[model samples]
Target: MTDGILVVGDISARAQAAVTGVVKALEKAFNAKDPIALSEQFALRTSWSNAMGTRLDDRRSIAESAAPAMEGFLCDSYARYDVVKLLEIAPNVIAVSVAQTPTDSSGNPIEGAWGATLYVISEQEEGWKIVAGQNTAVESSSA
Candidate 1:
């Protein structure tokens, strides 16, 4: 559905709530460093692939592999998303593009791996959640 306005459009209440839920859930999960909670935002058969060549399909596996990075090596600044746009590609599919950046533990800006995450969400009884995603890292920005 088109909102008629630029970024704001005629989005269904359920869809709007779903999008807001996903965004808030992610922000909280990352800030809390809770991988399990973070995994809940995705469906059981989600796929996460990054530019690092790491390709994983299972939600649990992705969470496990991300533990250390989310906990130690990286600064408290974890995965952050600046949603640029959202579009309903199909009746059951939604595509969202976001500008991602890494921050320090205090949530301060850091110069590191920066890229974009293009996610495709699917409608579920519980609401819309990510079913598949492709992460492209900013090669110029070193982590």
Candidate 2:
């Protein structure tokens, strides 16, 4: 999906919807600050790098790292994720680009907290799961 529109291609509508659905699920989980729920969107062997560049090798590790932050320092942090682009690299595989804007609990945007995330998702027996992801903070231009 790009700009709230799915990029038209040879991919099936069902596939597009499913991939988009996964991204929505992630947003939901993040807002809820449920580490377990958040990790559910990923595959068992997922590779994830947080916006701070901390790399986690699997879902368990991801959840483990998220628990304290979600319950402590980042307890009040919220974010909204928009799918900026989706590319079908191969059959049943999609590369998703997401724009993440930090928001308050009331869903109001927080300045200077923007981020971008790239997710590599694939269809598996359990459904669409993110296999790999990298999140990077968007820095303001000095110019």
Candidate 3:
């Protein structure tokens, strides 16, 4: 679906597949606990804001922090990433939102206001790379 965004227009099946692949790569990298490899998935000069508010503004910073930080929180957690929506904003750029639920090893939900991430991916000569991303907490509005 277009998510009611006229700018996205219509996407070809091939384009859709490529975008999906980028999402898959993200999950795979996280599951693998290889931060350096994960950073490679991003553009050389990228911006990433973690759910906890840590900001890595470039590939160098991302590679340095992502792995160490993730090791602590994700070591005993299991989460699945889902591509909630993909908006092709330009000829080679796509904005994506993903839904994820992190649970303990026993499948119990982790205590947190976290649920989704927003990403901007760009198609490079080799493949798609995330040029920017932000992980945020999902706060409830119900009182």
Best by lDDT: 2
lDDT of candidate 3 over 1-143, digit per residue (tens)? 54432235466767777777777777777777778777888888788998888988998898888777678866655655667677778887888877776655554566644467888988877688888999876863110
| Alpha-carbon shift of residue 100 in model 1 (angstroms) | 1.1
How accurate locally, in lDDT, is each candidate?
0.70, 0.84, 0.74
lDDT of 2 at 136: 85
TM per candidate comes to 0.78, 0.90, 0.80
Show where candidate 1 strays beyond 4 Å. 1-10, 139-143
* RMSD to truth, every model: 3.8, 2.6, 3.7
Q: List the residue pairs that clash in candidate 1.
A: 3-9, 3-10
Encode model 1's per-residue lDDT on 46-71: one tens digit a residue. 88785566877977887887677677
Candidate 3 C-alpha RMSD relative to the actual structure: 3.7
Model 3 whole-model lDDT (C-alpha atoms): 0.74
Query: Which scores greater on lDDT, model 2 or model 3?
Result: 2
What stretches of model 3 exceed 4 Å from their correct place?
2-8, 104-113, 139-143
- lDDT of model 3 at position 104: 57
